[model samples]
Target: MADALITLEAVSKRFGTVEAVRASSFSIADGEFFTMLGPSGCGKTTTLRMIAGFELPSGGRILLRGEDVTEVPPNRRPVNMVFQHYALFPHMSVLDNVAFGLKLKKVPKQERRRRALEMLEVVALDGLEQRKPQQLSGGQQQRVALARALINNPAALLLDEPLGALDVKLRRALQLELKRVQSETGTTFVYVTHDQEEALAMSDRIAVMNHGVVDQIGTPREIYEHPTTPFVADFVGSLNALEVVIDEVVGDSVVCRFGEVGRVVAPAPHGASSGSTWRIAVRPERVTIGTEQVAFDGGSRLSGTLQQVVYLGMLTQYHVDTPAGRVVSHRMNDEAGLSLETGAEVHVGWAADHTSVLGPASS
Candidate 1:
């Protein structure tokens, strides 16, 4: 954070009686693609607005490149915003939409046109500069919107779910395109999105927010593999949560018992003690499902009846019913275990290191 570009210090926002965002604090390094990810009404959008100077914080300060800009207006700040909808001028061509900002600044018409064309090329829409917004595809129009926002050379670009409107395939394509643009321009991007896949695919770092609280912030792998909270573990990916009672605490690990026939040795959470109930979670991909029992060194095992097999193009999921409730395991379409039929007895196993202790079980 020595070269922090955007910093939020105890920033919170309240809409009259409703607290939209709690005291949230984080730093975005220069040229980093930082994402605020959560479900709707989680205060992610409100937090983005506060950073963009559209909504002033009810508490704390926002700094851009070490300068306090909490009270700065949106237009005066060296930042630009792109919304879910591409707010393009219906009457103007794509080129004109891009050059609109430069025109407002009263730059020479020739210079503005030259820069607009260059920006179009950067977004891979150079040949369609003369087309109207309505004439282009959803993905193309989004690129135009991106080109328009980045054309101004803002120190940081704030995108509020810019890809939310596109179709699934198109959205997936643009996720990579957006990251490419951000990297090529070397502009710090403050992106907001509710899609877990989108956030994981494009972010250098992510802040997982829930009910106005910042639950965890980390890289995609860190957040997915080592979630510190139940919300993050359940929200970031498909998880199998099992409630268990601690039987013993052995050094750095805890032996927990679940249901009538399941026992697991998982890494102990802070302050873990015997007789305390806790929840442990494992990702679906980490669990292995098989008809025969397999010995796993330092791992946990469960016996269950295969309930269902879900085939999702490149991957498949096996849902098994065990004494501890239902557990799921994921495997690529080509992997073994796909031949197991539903209603057959199966063994589910995962390495102990892949399990995460999610504090305590909720009452």
Candidate 2:
């Protein structure tokens, strides 16, 4: 991590008796789209503010481009933050708003207009330079704010839920737009948001935070496919859990007894002990339900009664109550396919490799 653009070494933040951030540590590589993702009150915003120099760390250090900036003032850090609320000046045109930062740094009048116009063009808002903030749409105003922040060419850009105000469609649109802008500029972006889908869509990597502590940090695929902790597995997506009692641990595999349903064999999770209780989780899409028996290695099949059916346009979600436990299965909707009514008997199953052994529930 010698080339890390930003590094937080055991950074923590507190307000009086309440601790907002724990001793969180991570590094962002140069030109990477990194995200701090979690629900509200998870200290993601607090960590972002600490990096922006708006909130001083209670302990540990903050480094930007190899320089220690733990005590640096907001105006002095080599980073800029874009807030959810677009604090644009109503009296000033888009061009003027973008140029305001350069002006404060004593940029010349003619040069200000030139640089401002150029940055506006970078944001695809060149022709709208003369429009005031009041006359622009919400997304347009956000672009103006972004252009203003990027005019200084900071080492990194810190965004605090910048798209939280836009409508769903608009937000989705801008997610791609922002990714394009970030790629085009080649600036490291440390984006903060609570939206897991947004993080999966735009981030090179994500740090999932919970209760002022970072639970896991990894690529979207890794976070989804192999969540290390129960908190991460449950929070990142919808998962069905099955409690099992381990009969024995054979090498890296464990033999789990599923009561009268059946016995299952799966790879033991790292650090799992022999003859201990564990939870196995599978996604709804991974759970298959049918009256027909399927053949597959390391797959667990159980009998269940279909309890509920929810019809979505693309897929049908079936909830089943099994001897092992309740499970859900998702099947694609097809024009000529048959109908599986509720209260019917069905067999539920999934590949053991698709199963993940979750950490203790209390973790």
Candidate 3:
């Protein structure tokens, strides 16, 4: 897009014998909250570092606000970063820590303090500016880190797992807080994390990465509901898989014979061939289980033995053994006023449209 605030064009990075990032190309639109998400060693952090100018790309270019910044040093780029560890100086008070970057750039003493205090207020740390890092709690230190980064008022802010250090409750709180701050500033944010829920919760769009390459890039809803690949389907949420033998291709739909589960119809995945073996995938929440036969609106249904039942406060999850092997089904605690029990004979079903046919699993 023309309004992209940051563009990475065919960028690749190598370290000695290993390639840390492949030919990656993506654009973060102006004032958008974009995230890079993947498991460890998936090149998410390397991609962020290249954009930050901490690590140079071996090929292609990096552009910021329509200007080529591939050759620019870290300090020269119009960007600031909040590190995973906060990277706050323990010896310095919050004010000094936030003002350090401005001072390094030769900002005037009085102006730096003014900007620092303003950002501290922006991050809700106005009164605690004189406290050292050790004197503050984990969440407080994170806010200070954010204050320091935002004090520069850069075109974009880069966060590398910024909430990874806090406890679960605090991390959740900061996630929302960070989102609010980003909206209030209207500054583009490029966040990196391995947590799928965090990405889905906070990102306007997410680039799912694997094996040093971007596997898919889309809105959180697109990545979740219509995953383009098996990796994306497996990575983005809980999945249930069924092995099936493809019978034929009927237009854009594929007819498949699921083992011990009978025939099912699913939309053929792009590039799939007729009569080829495939794996059918469905999300756990998409499956419905009941002691009686349930109407199939658009999904395939089958009978399974309830092997285990786990009762969470909001929902009940059942581990079912079916002809297609083990399947996990989740039902809302109040859905149909039904309560599932172990050893129950239940029929499981889902809309056919929810089914995804994938490449046959490797033996």
lDDT string for model 2 (143-172, tens) is: 999999999999999999999999999999
Give the number of the best model, judged by lDDT: 1
Q: Estimate, for each residue in 58-108, the C-alpha lDDT of model 1 and write its tens digit.
A: 999999989999999999899999999989999999999999999999999
Off by over 4 Å in 1: 257-262
RMSD of each: 1.8, 2.1, 2.2
- Give the worst 10-residue stretch by lDDT in candidate 1: 256-265
Per-model TM against the reference: 0.95, 0.93, 0.92
Clashing pairs in 3: 298-351, 298-352, 299-350, 299-351, 299-352
Using lDDT as the measure, name the better of candidate 1 and candidate 3.
1
The lDDT ranking, best first, is 1, 2, 3
**lDDT digits (tens) for residues 1-363 of candidate 3:** 899999999999999989989999999999999999999999999999999999999998999988999989998899988898988899999999999989998999999999999888888889998899999999999999998888878999999999998899999999999999999999899999999999999999999999999999999988887777789999999888777666777788877655555456678776667656677788889887788875785447677789998989998889998776788998888786687788988888778788876567567
